[model samples]
Target: MDHRSETGHVMFLSPERVFYAGLLGRPRNRSTGSLLIYVGLGGRLMLTCGGRTQADLAIALIPPFVEHTIASDARSSLCFTVEPESVTPAALDLLARRAADQGPALAERICAAYVRLREGGCGPGFTTEELDTIVLGAPLARRRLDLRIAEAVARLNDFSGPAATAADCAAAARLSQSRFLHLFKQQTGTSFRAFRAHKRARHLLHFVNEDLNFAHLAQDIGYPDSTHFCHSIRRFYGLKPGAIFSGSRDLRIYRGAAQAEATAVAALA
Candidate 1:
């Protein structure tokens, strides 16, 4: 028998296998014997699974026989599933009695462990056990508006040349244009347009060495015309696009400046 096929079957039998496998974005096809818990930290997520209202940092303790889908707004996450019969009776009873407030410290630890795991570092052996303990202790809180907005801002840090509009960002966030603008301002303490322009300027500084066509770069990043794009760059960074990319300044200077600006904006958000 193929080990891969057997592995699939075994995934349903053990809670550890079930929990870790869920984190990889694929769940076993059958939900009849699984319970899933989603803990959102700093971003927005959309769940396709039948559930209550959509909100930031939403948590759903899905019982057996329910299937769900989850989407997040450029933020990291930690999710797990438990086999119905694998969890101790004591653990199930605790989960039934707890409220959402009891999961922050657990969330924090999970987030930290996830980061370490992503970086190829050795995570503490007790991390998963601690996570299980937290889930049993209390309900996990929802994500905050400020963190979601900050995540939006962070996404822009990778943009270069020209900036996208609030409407574009709203579509990305899956929110109404008006609501996105309001929420963006509330969380980032800046207008969406301003933040986008800053992001574009930072990208241009980083990519100026590449023999990219200004017009194409502008259009690629959502600007309508080269003239308008250059004008925006000049107004914000006090340097025309051509002049900055002309090789006058040391490449290191441009890189350092851009990184500093991006860092400052992130900190502000």
Candidate 2:
């Protein structure tokens, strides 16, 4: 293993996802809201899960909120955390199951995209949607969701206020608590609470670059107390808040290309 990838670089950050290129110091075991695709850009990596180490991999796909650790040589790597529903299911399953080796092909495309960005041929680098499209090829069949349930998901994603409860979601979707709960699980393949928590946890992404301390950051993101904030961070990212926050210190966080551009403009203003 190379000892060179100890340096880390963050390329983009948003509420829904983030992309990183460069060395990632040891990451916390916190679960994340979106699916994680850790692409090995240079040296080989060692991914540890459930007390085991998976080394010599070109890429790894981790499902949301599943705790794991990655040990890598100090080499360049590219990573993206993509929104669950926004990514095509076929692509997600392909990487997650490890049923086949798509690593070489995926790596080639990523390298090309990186090269193009470095040459300033494009602006804002690659995006989650673009990467998903590149990997998945054509569109795949989507799960048929109840319109009401789908509306509820939209609301969940958009809601910025207090933590939404099951009752609240049911009301928003215009369904009884029981019926809505049933449909939500069937349509989304996860319990309502888990889905909502992941959505809520994603709110922390916006503040990744803020100067605020944990207390204020927690409140600003709608966590009830420090305890809840810490717990939520752990569950979402599988690591302690302090570790995650400290690890991201040098990251140039952004919500999107527009937000990043706006921030740059404001700095000059």
Prediction 1 global C-alpha lDDT? 0.48
- The C-alpha stretches of model 2 lying farther than 4 A from their native spots are 1-8, 13-17, 95-99, 117-128, 131-144, 257-269
CA lDDT scores, all candidates in order = 0.48, 0.63
For 1-269, candidate 1 gives per-residue lDDT tens digits of 43322221111111121222111232222232345655664654555555543545545455644555555553334455553333454565465444255545545554554444334332222232443443343222222345546556545654432355677678878889989889886664456776566555445544554568999888766668899888776654345677656632222211223344553565576
- What tens-digit string does per-residue lDDT give for candidate 2 at 139-173? 32344567887777766664244556789888887
Error of 1 at 117 (Å): 28
Poorest 10 consecutive residues of model 2 by lDDT? 1-10
Top TM-score hit: 2
| Residue 55, candidate 1: C-alpha displacement in angstroms | 52
C-alpha lDDT of residue 109 in model 2: 68
Q: What TM-score goes with each of the models? A: 0.37, 0.76
